[model samples]
Target: MATIFTIPGSLRSGSSNHNILKFLGTLVPDGINYTIYDSLATIPPFDPGLDNDTTPQPVAELHRLITNADAIIICTPEYAFGVPGQLKNALDWLVSSGTLVDKPVALITASSSGEYAHPSLLRTLGALSANVIEEACLLVPFIRARIQDGVLDDELKEQLESAFESLLKAL
Candidate 1:
């Protein structure tokens, strides 16, 4: 069974990004072991000072989690018209560790139509040496309206299912 590492870019508990991740969790089919990084809020701001041998335990755990995962799925919401600070901070921690190098990753965005923020994320992920599967980018427009209680609307659900399949194949 493949291990799926889910990263919700939002730190807010009820954020749309988190909700999207929950929706994807339900889409994980049989034989797939999955886990979501629920400690984004606990991650401190990335700093060279703290990147040494004795960093906080939570930061070390986060690095270990990403390094051990088979594949990564990121569900993010745009903040200030760009990637959220928490998500960027998480990636910053990985920049010096090479944890995501050559890793198969899928970036999903939950935003209104015509409001996607993936190109920037894609560029950043590529710069970090991630093998981002282009076909696995899932954009759920009007996400709040389309997915309720972690259940996607019929059309979005189908798209998410297909995206999940594509991600698994990318691995």
Candidate 2:
């Protein structure tokens, strides 16, 4: 079975991005294990000086999870025309650790105007040497409007399903 580690950029409970990730979990095909990494808030700010073997417990846990996963899906919201600080920090922590190198990743920017963060996130992941699947990377603009009461409309659901299928194929 393939394991997918999903990371939502928002820290707020019931956020659109988080809810979307949860929805995707339900759409996973048989033999695929989907898990959401809900500890972004628990991870302390990245500190290069303390990035050695004795890193923070949360950081270590994050690394372990990503390392164990067969693939990764990052669903994020744009914050002030950029990636969320917490999510960026998590990536920063992985820079020197080589945890994401050559790892299959699918980037989904789900926001009001996801355009800004989409390219920026791709560049960041590229710098980390992640095997970003271009076909699977998607910009889900106006995501809040596409989902209501934790449910996605048919159009959005179809789009997300296509992206998910591309990710699985890439893996």
Candidate 3:
């Protein structure tokens, strides 16, 4: 079975990013193990000193999940015109571990104006040497308008479906 892991950049309970991940889960085919990681808030701040084998349990678990997954989907909302703090911290933990290196990853930046954070995250992922699927990368501005009552608009849904299909094909 193909293992697919998803990460939501926001810690907010009703986050659009989390909702997007949930929607993505439904697009997975049978026999694929899909998981939406909900522990971004639990991961402590990045410390180069603690990046060894004895890392924190949450960070270690995240590393293991990414290392084992066939592909990863990250849906995030920009904060303060930049990547969310918690999400960036989580990526920081993965840098030394090299867990994302060569991993098939799809990035979705959904926010009021995801312009800044979308490309910012792309650069960060590039630094990690992640094999990001260009066709799977999406930037959805005014995201709140694209989703209503947890339902994505037709255009957004179609775009997400196409991006997800691209990621699945890369696996």
Candidate 4:
């Protein structure tokens, strides 16, 4: 079975990012193992010195997961008009490791006026050499209100569903 991993950029419980992941999980078809990485908080600061054969346990674990997954989905909300610090830190650890290099990734910037963060994150992913699927990426502005509507709104639901399906196709 194919495996797909999701990483929510927000650390807050019940965050719109997490909820988005949960909603996507429901759309996972059979013969696919969908997993959500919920340990972003555990990823320590990016220390180039510490990133080696004896890397931090949390960083190693995250690396292992990303390496094993067939594809990656990163859904995040911008903070102070930029990518969240923790999420950026996590990506930093992967820079030297090249864990995301050539990996199929789908990015979703779901926030109020996500314009700034969305492009910034795309650049970061590009720097990682990640194969970010263009069709799979989305910038969802005013995401909280959309999440509240949830499955009720056919258009938004279809859009989110299409993003996930696009990722699956990329794999």
Q: Find the candidate with the highest lDDT and give its number.
A: 3
Which parts of model 4 have CA positions greater than 4 angstroms off?
A: 149-152
Alpha-carbon lDDT of model 3: 0.94
TM-score of each: 0.91, 0.97, 0.98, 0.96
Q: Give the TM-score of candidate 1.
A: 0.91
Error of 1 at 104 (Å): 0.5
Regarding lDDT, does 2 or 3 come out ahead? Answer: 3
1-171: candidate 4 lDDT, tens digit per residue: 788999999998778888888888999999999999989999988999999987999999999999999999999999998999999999999999999999999998888988988999999999999999999999988887776634325666789888888998999
User: What are the clashing pairs of model 1?
Assistant: none
Question: For each predicted model, how many residue pairs clash, with residues at least 3 apart or on different chains?
Answer: 0, 0, 0, 0
lDDT of 2 by residue, 71-152 (tens): 9999999999999999999999999989999999999999999788999999999999999988888898888888898888
Instruction: Name the candidate, 3 or 4, with the larger TM-score value.
Output: 3
Clashes of 4: 0
Full candidate order by lDDT, most accurate first: 3, 2, 4, 1
Ranking by TM-score: 3, 2, 4, 1
How do the residues 53-155 of candidate 3 rate in per-residue lDDT, one tens digit apiece?
A: 7799999999899999999999999999999999999999999889999999999999999999999999999999999999999999999898898988999
Question: What are the lDDT scores of the predictions, listed in order?
Answer: 0.82, 0.92, 0.94, 0.90
